[model samples]
Target: MAERRMMLRDPGLQPERTRLAWSRTAFSLTLFGLLCFRGWCRDGNLFYGVSALISGVALTAMLAGWHQRHGKQFLSLSLWSVGALLLLNSLRQVLA
Candidate 1:
């Protein structure tokens, strides 16, 4: 009888890459939120304030799920929330 050998699959650095990507997204959201807050403070506009609040909430959600092994759902929802807020804000600006 002949012996059969099995090969193992390597995951490589995909996990690390994913973590780094998330970190970059978090950093971008933080910067955007800060800018929105600054705009609100300077112009006293409700839209800017609301946008800032949404960004903060999204960022918080991202951070809350950062250490979890299965946090993709949380991150996805947060990103979608931010996208929706941005779209609404853009439409408001265009209409006004």
Candidate 2:
């Protein structure tokens, strides 16, 4: 008798694509945070400064845990947070 390796038949490419999305989301959030930080450092108040800092931290944590989460929840949360950051960043600019 010979031992054989077992693998999922499809091993679908969806996982890879989903991971890429997470990576992209993380990158976008981090980039936004850095840009906002720089911008706010000049005329930005404490509110913006703290918000930007927190966003950066969140982005880092998201990237570090990206591969350590379940598919549905991970994707949903990452995307929602990304959208939130974008909204907040834009709102800061508009209100200023």
TM-score of every model?
Answer: 0.67, 0.57
- Name every residue pair that clashes in candidate 2: none
Q: lDDT for every model?
A: 0.78, 0.66
For model 2, the stretches where C-alpha displacement exceeds 4 angstroms are 1-10, 70-96
Candidate 2 displacement at residue 1 in angstroms: 36
- Across residues 15-36, which tens digit of lDDT does each residue of candidate 2 receive? 8987798778778777777766
Largest lDDT belongs to which candidate? 1
Return the top candidate by TM-score: 1
Ten residues in a row with the worst lDDT in model 2? 1-10
Task: Name the regions of candidate 1 deviating beyond 4 angstroms.
Answer: 1-9, 66-74
Error of 2 at 41 (Å): 1.0
Q: Where is the poorest 10-residue window by lDDT in model 1? A: 1-10
**What clash count goes with each model?**
0, 0
